[model samples]
Target: MRARSHSPRKPKPNSVMGSPKMKSKSKSPQKKHRAVINQLDYLNSQCHMEGCSVSIVVHSTRFLICRHQLCHASDYFKDLLQSKYGSEDFYVTVSSMSEPTPSTQFRWFVESSIPCPALKDISDETLETCMRLSRRFDAKGLEMRCTKFIVENACSRQPIVALCWLNWALKHKFDAQTQASCLPSVARLSLTALEQHRHMLTEKIFSDLLAAKLRGTYDKAVQVFRAIHRMDHFSVEVDRCPRCGRTRDGMRVKVNADPCRKQIGCDRCHRESCEIENKAGDDLQAFYQCPHGLVPLNSTTDECHCQIPNLAHHLGSRYYFRSENGTILNPPPLSPHTSRTFDPAEDTSERPGTSYKRQTSRDMDRREQRQSAVVVRLEMLVVSLQPEESVRRAEIVSFGSSVILSIAFFYIFTMLNAFTTTNIALLDKSSGCFEKKISKYYGQPKKLWERFSRAVSLCSPRLHSVELGAFANTDEFKVPLLAPSEDCVVLSLGIGKDVKAERRMRDRMSQCVFIGADPVNESNADLFSQVGKFYNVAVGHKNGSFRSYVLEDVYRYQEVAYMDLATFIKLNVNRKIVDQMMMDVEHAEYPVLPFLEKGGELSQRDIAINIEIHRPTSEDLQAFVGFLRRNSLSQQWIFINSEIHPFFKHIRLFMINGQNKECRRRFWEN
Candidate 1:
């Protein structure tokens, strides 16, 4: 290694700087102009700014100025002046002063550089013009002073002026502080004030007003819920015992008073009555009065009724019921168990100024508030929580909400697959592969038989059968229905990319008419082309374009087109009766099946549905099976082998019009 000298390199003659490390002053025209403009303008006359290239013309009056002074107020002016004329020899013209509306504003803004009272004691119109100019130039000091003065004097004295200013600021998208300062007071404006000054509101202010009104309505609703919850009883049907689901009967039995002894025609009673009457005349003593006032005694048995229990007394009762029209009907008692009855006359007389719409005592408005809480509202919950626990609570709420949403989605998905999917859990080799079968696991399984035991316990639909006995199959997929041949019209919705099932059915039933529907336009065109008269549409319960979400192996969701099944069938199928329709429209089976059942469309034809279910639990399957049974349709299921898909499984459900009660499979103690 050689020793190195620690000396700097020598500068070249061409380079003004000694080295790259050495600092040099490279004076561009912009720097020279900026240096001159940096000096404070003390004199009002243009003669003071000597050697100026730019001439600022305000309303035909020309004021010669250095280019740097014109650019000093804002970067916008600086960029404008520099970019307008690149040459330093030519005079650049400033034209903002030429406009009639902005001429005075421009003069004031230009003069504001030196501390002066140019803005003092001006008309609101002039001040507004000055403020606009300040905003245009982004002069923060002028804008702040204008805002402070206007808000303190003009806005404070006349709120309409405040609204006007706010409206202006919002229209031009001015300083947020100015706009925000006006919002709270504007929001607090009474309806009377709003109506009176309604003309002052621009589109932007109107939108803000609408948003504020919505927020206020929401806040009021929350407050009402909190208030009602605190009361001993609410008109809502949520007032039930936390521990038990039962409600006490409103009416209590009253014991009849003992038959009056005075009615007896005895001489002793007459003598006692005469003596009591005579003693009343002689002795008159003061008696204490009841604090509650004298209550009128009920003479008749009918009038001696006891108070009834309020709906709140029934916490866990299923008061809500869906009608045939799909509306939820909660027929709670008309009168709520308030300590004070809602005397409309008295309420109106006392609160004379309050309109009927503003009355909180009305029960109609409170109907939606039923079952709004398990404990309390989220606002209350947050307030009651500790600061440290708040974070934990938020995390819990977020996680819990996500979980609930996931569960709800899963449930909806399950219900959707209810009608379309088939059961084959108990289908043996003897039962044709296409036939749906129900689990015949009435007997308890031995622990040694793990798979069978698990299948018997978990896979069996009987657990839910008791709840819906009317719909449960008396037997497995053992209904005595002959297999379809030439007379059959088969419609299969959502044939997979393979089209294995559709091809097999078409091949087996050569004389039958086959129609298949799928909406994978690009990739599955070839597969769908293989089937007879396949349509590029999805089958849902109704007639519309539905978005089908497909979860791919790559962990991404792809959406496809979905069409209504009824409309497709009506358009495509010539035969009145569809012998078998295999539906594999993912979770779409939920709405489709219900639609069929609800409209009695299932009964119109002898259709056997062999649909593939997507991820249905035992409960879901049971509900589905029950739905089939309720429709007087015999249902069978074919379970998807777990080997094919690790997580997702399919079911092939079969439905027929008649029942086979005699074929009911039962467990006899062996």
Candidate 2:
């Protein structure tokens, strides 16, 4: 069935250019048609892809359909006919006399096999040229990068063919700027003539990844990238550190020391003190204290590196203290304290004569005075580890006070236990000037406690509250309604129709400026007018086209919500900020979301978004919700109403700017 079936039968030079079969003038229609079919076969045989054949069409009287079935180029011919005729058939009446004949020409379609290999040989330099050309906004270089590279390097003359290749390259994602720049020259070419033949030259250049990108197939694009690099083949293994291999949690911290106690606190978050300090300093020995009063070092032993108890220690409920003399640790048991003590190393004797002469070289009288300065030594007495008498004395001096304090605390706690709830309430009212009210209940038995130990008493748009201080370390630490910072807050609206909804939102932010289609880009202060005023904006478009523009500045706000629109808006909204999104991007929300995630540089939409579900097949709506869940966006839509499309359900708004892992899992499943 293949041409290779008779490859050994080399064609004669005359046979290669096969002669057309002649038919008798008086022959019946069937015989003439049969004869024409035979000639057509011979002509096709001569034009096998690359061989004992010619690459040209021969004049014949054959019926194209029958001739095609038995010809070497049958597949190619079938394609040619179907493209020329979309199924309808007509019988052509052939006559011996003809007035004129249409000219027929052959064009070679460079198949995939050849182009792939050629692309493989393309140098990285050529690729760079291609990429650069893609971004260029010029005319002389308006050719497709690859085509231009080929022309510049391959052609010594024949500049015109290079131009032809340039025309060919345009199909492969020509730099839009180049097309625009070259528009003037193309104006002279008849639009019909240009459409008559495209040559499909650009199709040869797009590698799979590039094609996926052009198609906006982001997931496919990611997959194609994986293929190119074998990214999964490699992974990161934490380096087993050389010394001790302890895997010390290494990070830098700057410290500001307390002036009184010389204790250091973290510069970034003083709420908790950090132990490590690779902070900058000149004197390593005195790393704890700089003349500027900030000491940073890694020694957090009994004494901080600065040799001072950090004054900041008092800032926290937990604290640490070190004694210069271990004996001071247990006043009464001095003998036992000495038993655990080690002698301090003596300082090296100062270079005697060196200090003497240096003192003389500087201010003579002052130098003399410095050289004669007296050094003081304080002597410490050591107690003998004699008998139980010293232990008894330790108990009397140190434990005596602790014993009294403990007894006093016991009595105080016993009496106050009855008033714990009352005290808690009084503390709440008195100390909550800058905090929300706190609720109190008696600490109860474990089983009883589980019934009401924790609860979100109420929700408010606030950043500080008494409940927060009490539940600071609880599982419910993060607040959903409470946002990060006031400066970073925004109540944006995706104002489409829904005039009632818009009006309601406007009242909420009556001070914010409204920008509609044909927008008068307002001033910043005007945009945020009222105290807590918002900025009312209709994204990208002025008023009513399906086209949406990007709001780069809007992304500065941490959250964005849209009911309906295109995917580009979603994507631009996702990057940098946008912790929450409100979906409903036109009637196209569901289909468009998939594209935004799939094609754009978006891995996940970590936004609490709500959508007025557009009318979609049940399967599609489920899939869309599932997709939202997979990407970790909550999908609690409450269908309170649906007028335009019955399938469109206005569900209860379910969002998640910040929620637990379970919420995340439920929202973005995959």
Candidate 3:
């Protein structure tokens, strides 16, 4: 069969095997098909090269990526390549994904030559996807890049976007820095907007936002009140030339004594007779000298009636005036000058010499008239400068607005109070304990209930209370109206991320010494150390090593040293009587308070304590009350932090030593 058929098939011109045209036509179709495949399978065409070692399949889309390149770029890929199935091709299938999908993001991330992907051209949706994927795969570099971009770009421009980012970050438990950067924008959102997006925020964050809004409103009200109150009733005294009794504008007569001199002589009389003239003839003058260096009028002219200058005509001239406080006034008053029509028929024709004297006398009378006019103008100016009826009305409106805002704030504060659902028995004042039986107490045993009831009944009376730290996270205390001594000492325990209260205290009492302590050393040292000494130790029940979790971000923990209240006081404060003690030790207050009470450390000093009780149970409350009673501490102020927990989770209590005579004399008696 081979001997018969080998050379016989090449006869036709259109045959694909023999003709060049036929061969070219067949290749053209194949080329077009390949181009279509390359366009449709873009990922494979770009990534499926000779060096590629792994195949990543995202929603049935295959991407052949270089193993070393991808592993170096992503921690997820690094681990995946070292896994059991790493020797074979790897597949990642993401279902039900949106645009700028996981596969596309992965490709972009892998191909990115720069340390961080360029965010300019990337849409927010694409960036969000990158953030999500980076977080899932532990791509720390990409994660940080995305966080920085969102915070710096999105946060600064659009507050709503920033709020969204904040909600997302908070939900995912992002770093504290990221959350803090987004907080300002979130704080700017209106109550309505916040309510609309309330579902997106945590309860704690929502409460904080509301508090911030309230604080802003309060601040604006205070500013308006201050502005209204600062308005003064100003009066101006017009300065006049002693000789001619004329103002600067009316005394426009130049002297010929010296070209460089500002000495002004009377135009009618050639000699300088004003009080501003130098007696030594040195041309030295006072600041109140006449603007045109005018000389005095003739002495014979007893009542010269000089024409008063128009207020607008003297716009370029300087007029000296004194305020009611005896200070020089700038931009002198604009009251209209009084004018009188001259009677031309009053004086008859006279001899030449007598006419000169009569004319000079007439000019003097005109000058006197000008002086009277200036006086009338000054009086009008004083009346005009005084608060007008409209201004008074505006003031009333402002005060009314402030009062309304204050009432609104109070209403909100009271309405937001979330008390425990458990009913507390009434306190028996005589016995200093609850009337209900121990069995009736909610969830507590008999002994615990008795102690709790007794503690609850023991109320620490307050004489005077004042709120310090006007802004967010303020502190209330029983402070004396009189300023403390320069050697005053303040102890701040558990100084977490907030130093606003401390900073305010420092501003009020600059000479007082502040000492702060906290377990987390990250930013506490930098923040607290700016105003006072900072110690990296937790205030607890005992002095030893302990593990403490960060309050701002609960996921983070720190191995820190712990010091009891007494030990901390003795060591850091040099055993000095603490003037003010601020304690916010999360839940450690339960044990630390009892320990301090047992050790009699609080009783030994006349201390003003500002303490925050966190997540207190009925037993804890009883113990706290008992501790205060035993220490003879009077509760000066109390606030429930609804932001942390809606149901009495955090209680801020301020107390002062009632037994200490000095404390009573300093704060309560005053």
Which candidate leads the pack in TM-score? 3
Candidate 2 segments whose C-alpha is farther than 4 A from its true place: 1-485, 489-494, 499-575, 595-606, 625-652, 657-670
Highest-scoring model, lDDT: 3
Candidate 1 vs. true structure, TM-score: 0.26
User: Between the candidate structures 2 and 3, which one is better when assessed by lDDT?
Assistant: 3
Model 2, range 1-670, lDDT digits (tens) per residue? 6565644666565444477455557757543222232222233333343232222222333222222321222343334444353323222332222322211111011110112113223332334233322333121222343444453443332333433434534644554343333323332333233323223222232122233332344334434543543432322234332223323256433434432234434433244432222111111222234444644332222334333433323222122233554322212222221221111121133544556555554456454444433211111122333475786667656976998999999999986774444422332332232122212322222221222112212222222231211111111111112223321222233333222332333344343332222112334323334222333333321224343432334522223322232343353332333333334333444554553343332224333343444444555545554453434323122111112221223222223433233323332221
Residues 1-670 of candidate 1 have per-residue lDDT tens digits of 9899989887776666734444457654332221222122323355344544455544434434456655665555676676665324332233344444333555555665323223254346656665666667556656666677655654354556667777777655665666766765676676557645655555456567756775576456545543443352212233333223334477322211112222322222233433222222112111223443433222111211121123323322224443344444454444332222223333433444656545654564354345444223553565467877977898988999999999999999987666343222232321332222222321212221223223323333321121211111111121112233346676767655645545545555667777777766554566557657778776786665555754233222455565666667778886677766666676777666665563455545544455555555455555455453444233322222111122233443443322222112211010
Tens-digit per-residue lDDT, 384-489, candidate 3:
6645577766776799899999999998876555221111111112122222322244344334433442343344221223223322333333232223554688
User: What lDDT would each prediction earn against the true structure?
Assistant: 0.48, 0.32, 0.56
Error of 2 at 315 (Å): 62
TM-score (all chains, Cα) for each model: 0.26, 0.19, 0.36
Model 3 gets an lDDT of: 0.56
Question: What order do candidates take by lDDT, descending?
Answer: 3, 1, 2
Give the range where candidate 1 is weakest over 10 consecutive residues by summed lDDT. Answer: 466-475
lDDT of 2 at 145: 38
